[model samples]
Target chain A: MSMRDRLRTMGLGAFGLLLVIVSWEVIGRNQLLGRTFPALSDVLATIVDPARRGLFQRALEATIGSALRGFVFGSIIGFAMAALGVIFPPLRAGLDRLAAVMHAVPLIALGPFLIVTLSREGTPTAIATLAVVFNVFVATSAGLRVGNPLHHDVLTVLGAGSWERFRRLELPGALPFIADGLKLAAPAAVIGAILGEWFGAPRGIGIVIVSSLQNYQIDLLWSAALLGAMLSLVAFGAFSVLERWVVGRFR
Target chain B: MLSPGAELSSESDKSADGSTDPSIEHDDISISTSPVLPHVDASEIGPANLSLSGVTKRFPLGRNDTVLALDDISLDIAPGEFVALLGPSGCGKSTVLRLLCGLEEPTGGDVRIRGCHPSELVADHRLGVAFQDHALLPWATVADNVALPFKVAGQPVDNDRVRSLLELVGIAEFAKARPKQLSGGMRQRVSIARALALRPEVLLLDEPFGALDAVTRRRMNLELQDIWSTDQITTVLVTHSVEEAVFLADRVVVMTGRPGRIQTIRTPGFERPRSPELLRSPEFHELVDELTIALDEEPA
Candidate 1:
């Protein structure tokens, strides 16, 4: 893409964001939602408040750590399972069904089970991992199978063995799909972590929101929810960058 | 089946391919040939014989549907001889190349390279092929792409060989550039360079320049002819373009579409290291027109 086009896209994105913030301030200040909802400015101020800095920091740190751990674990397992399906075609349908089945099981339902089987702190990461696994597996398996026939023919005529074919063709060809999955899984991982935290985790955005709401600390609740949104947004942004790079390289 | 080590050059090889092109289907499949190698009329045969004896390929299209892409095709490509498979689209010219490269199995008969199966040649990295689609790995640089067969064969990266091939194909300057960075013609050149990197016993080209523009295609044809002349490897080229077939091959084997059978096997009497002048020559045009007409007609 040209420099002018890229700048235009960024300018449009910034304008859209500004419009949302203006709407939020206008709605909240005018008592549109009965003052229960805080303005975007108020939420931002609460996040950076000196008195509550440490509280926000600890919550951000814990949540970020859990989400990162889950993302890593989920991505690896998902990629491996997809590769397994590609190498062994017989297992493809079964693996696909397994991913679909896992997705069908609600995260909220699994929360109680996870908390019972594992600790509260571990539960968040586990749930986050499950969310990422499904996205990554589906994308990876589909990616591995795609853009292959011609390349497969090239590799085959080059005398590549099954291992070499997987290594040289299938793996690289599937990278863009894996990256896409990772991008989609990022927000999901954060959501999973927050959901898991709702089941009595020690210190996280989920915990802060739940406690603040119960104690009637409206600003704190809004601040914590906004922080969670930012965290998910940041992860999503990072993965989008990765996805762009991979697609450029692989395709 | 004709063994791979059989005579690479047989004057009778032409007759073995027969006057009736497999591209055109007649009611009679009464083609005559031994199950083994063609009866050599000439004593001075070449070094390597890449022969397909009565090779038939039937692709199963879903449960009960099966497409017979090749039907009892027989052709012997002698060592250092360049033969082009000229036919209409879907005439199974690609299938013949695929069979020789061991990408597809003949549902009947055999495809042999050097007294062994095509797979053996491929496994040993002694077979080179370039398809119409320049399947250069998108991630790899031109140099790295050219060096792939070496890496695949479990050999150390022959950077020198890769460089020379890139130079040979006139893309040495773009060695560090990835495939997507190059133009269509340039990518095809890189693919061709990569194919020649190994200097295999037999080279199979399935319309390597098919994707290029007309001008680029002509230029590439001249360049390929020059390359092939130097290497003198046994080769089978699959192309629908009569001009390309006439320009590049010792013999053009035209086939009919749909259950592909040879339509005509005509030898273009062009000398080695042929020039652009020959392309404009009356003889070349005559041969091209003849093949084009042969390609246009279907068997009764």
Candidate 2:
């Protein structure tokens, strides 16, 4: 896309964000949703207050660590699952059903079980890993199947074996799709990490949310929620850039 | 089925002798003039280098429904000969090429190269094909795309061979460019170069220039002829263009659509090293007109 077009798209997005912020501030100040909803400025003040800086820092660090670890682990497992399906055609139907079944089970319901079996500290990363696996598996499997059939024919006539075909054609062709899966998996990882922490994990944004809700610390709760959202957004933005580069090269 | 080694080596020996003499003389011709193609008579050739006897293909379209794409088609291509399967759309000409390359199996009958199954050639890494779509890897540079056959064959890529092929196809300068960065003609050239990389015993082309403009297509045809002349590999070209079939092939096998069958076979009988002058000749126009008429009547 041209620079002007990119700028115009960014301008429109910024306008939309400004409108949302204005509406949020007006509603919160008016207490339209009652005392639970804090004004935007009050939430910002709570987040920036020097007294609570250490609390916010520790929470962000723990949550970010869990999400990052889960994202990497989940991505590797997901890709492996997809590759296995391609390598063994007979196992494809079974693997597909497995992924579907995994996705059907909700992360929220698994939180208590994970906390017990994996321990409080490990639960967040485990839940985050589960959250990412389904999306990556589905995206990668679909991606691996999407190359031009002509390319397949060319390889076949050239006497390529299954391994060579996968290595040379299917894998490279699936890069854009894999990147897309990773981009989508990023936000889910963060959400899963925060949710896992809510089930009595160590210091994290999720713990701050639950404690603030219990004690009626509305400003702190809002601040924590905003921070979690920013974490998800940052991961999403980074992967979006990577996705564009892959699509440019492989598609 | 023909045994692999003994027959192939003999066929190669015969072709090698025919091609060597013409190539030296061919180097004297300017780029604008066509290379002197070795004239090997279809009748004088020993045995079928590529044969399809009573070939039939039926594609299952849906449950209980099957489409008969080709019915009882048989053809024999001689060693070091160029044969063009010329027909209108859905004539199963491409199917013939597909059968020859082991990409598709015959529902009945046999498709063989040197008496062995086409798949045998494919397994031995001795069959090469170029499609209408080019199918060059979007991510790879032109040189790498051309080098792909060697890589696929589990052989070390001969960089010099790849470079010479780029030069042969007149795209040497575009070696660093990716498929998407080049024009349609250049991309097809790269595809052809890739197909030729391993020096396959048989070369199959399925409308390699089908997507280009008339001017570019004609130019590509001339270049293809020049390339083919040097090696004289047994080749089968699938195309609908009457002019193209007449200009390039030793024999033009015309076919009819709807249960595709060979309607007729015509030998243009043009001399080797046929030039641009041949394209405008009365004889060339007459043959093209006759084939065009035959193609027009294919539906009936």
Candidate 3:
């Protein structure tokens, strides 16, 4: 993009964000939604408040650790499933239905079952993995199918075996789609971790959210929610950059 | 045993110089031509005789509906022979090439390369093919693309062979460039280079230069001729261009559409390493004209 076009894009984004912040602050100050809603400034103050700094730090560390672990494990499992389907044509329809069913089952309903099976400490990562697997699986399966037909013909004429075809053509061709899937999966991992924490995890942003809601600590609740949003946004933004690089290299 | 267009043989006087050494005129070529333009030696490449006996192809159009693409086609390609399949659009000339490559199977009869099934040649890694699409991997550098056949065959990539093939196609400087980075002609050159990497016995070309403009296509034809001169692999090219068929092939198999079958097979008895000058000769135009008329004739 040209310098002016990039600047224009940033300017437009800033304007939209400013509009959102101003409307939020206005509604909170006027008590438009009653005492439950807090102004943006009050939420920021609570987030930076010295007394709550240690608590926020521990929660952030735990949630981030779980999300990262889930993202890695989910990506591996998802890629493996997609590769398996490609290798075994007979399994493709079954795998597709399985992925659809997995995605259809809500994470909230699975939270209690996960807690019982894996205990409170493992629930967060498990939920995050479930949340990420479907996106990665769908994207990877489609990606594997998106290879150029001509390239396949070339390999066939070259006498490439199934393994060689997968390694040289299908794998390289699927990188862009896989990167895009990962981009979406990143934020999903964060949301899953936060949701998992709600089912009585020891310490996380979700715990802060639940505790603040019950105790009527409106500012703390808003602060925790905002922090969760920021984590998700950062994950999305990082993968966006990586996705662009992969697309440029592979596509 | 008269030729089909024998009445148009007035250009016989012009063919006297058809046997002249083509390398003497290489300096006049616009592109950086190959230096080692050897005459095609029949004994150089092994027995790669391609034969299709009573081959028929039918593609399913819809439920209970089928389109006849080719019918009752039979031809035998001798070793070290260059044959061109010429026809109008949708005449199934490409289907014939595809059958020989084992890309598509005939609904009837048999297709063989060197006395074995077409698939057998593919399995043995003795088949080379270049399509109109070029089919170059967009992500790979030209050098890697050329080395792909070796890797596919579970053999170590011969880098020296790859480099020389690029030079043979006159694009050695673009070795590190990706397919998207080059123009249409350049990409086709890379595709041709990759096809020749393994030095396969049978070479199949389906309008490898069909996508290029006229000027570039002519230049590519000359380059292909230079390349063909060295290896003399049993080649079968499918094309719509009458001139290209005559210039490149020892035998031009003309076909008609709608249940495509051979209309005529004309042998342009021009000597090896034919130069650009041959393209302008009266004999070349005569053969092209005859084939074009044959191509235009409606199938009965």
Candidate with top DockQ is 2
Candidate 2, B1-300: lDDT as tens digits: 233233334444544565422234435443312333334332232212787888899999999999999988877666657889998888899988888888899999998787788877788787779999999999899999999988898999999999999999999999999898899999999999998887776889999999999999999999989888776667789998889999998778888988998777776767778788999999999999988887787455
Give the clash count for each candidate: 14, 3, 0
Model 3 TM: 0.92
Best-fitting candidate, scored by TM-score: 3
For residue B263, what is the lDDT in candidate 1?
A: 61
Model 3 stretches astray by more than 4 angstroms:
B1-47
Each prediction's TM-score against the native?
A: 0.88, 0.90, 0.92
Cα deviation at B131, candidate 2, in Å, is 0.9
Sort every candidate by DockQ, greatest first: 2, 3, 1
Tens digits of per-residue lDDT, candidate 3, A112-228, equal: 999999999989999999889998999999999998898999999999877889999998999999999999999999999999999999999999999999998889999999999
For candidate 2, state the interface root-mean-square deviation in angstroms to 1 decimal.
Answer: 0.8
Q: B1-300 in candidate 1: lDDT tens per residue? A: 222223223434543574422211211331222112344332222224677888889999999999989887877765556788988788898888888888778999988876678887777777788889898999998899999998888889888889888888898899999998999999999988888877776788998988888999999998987677665566788887889889888777878978888666777756556788998899989988877887788778
Better of 1 and 3 by lDDT: 3
Report every candidate's CA lDDT: 0.82, 0.86, 0.86
Looking at model 2, residue A10 earns an lDDT score of: 97
**For each candidate, what's the DockQ?**
0.66, 0.83, 0.69
Docking class of 2: high
**Candidate 2 Cα errors over 4 Å, as ranges:** B1-48, B297-300
Give residue A127's error in model 1 in angstroms.
0.6
The TM-score that candidate 2 achieves is 0.90
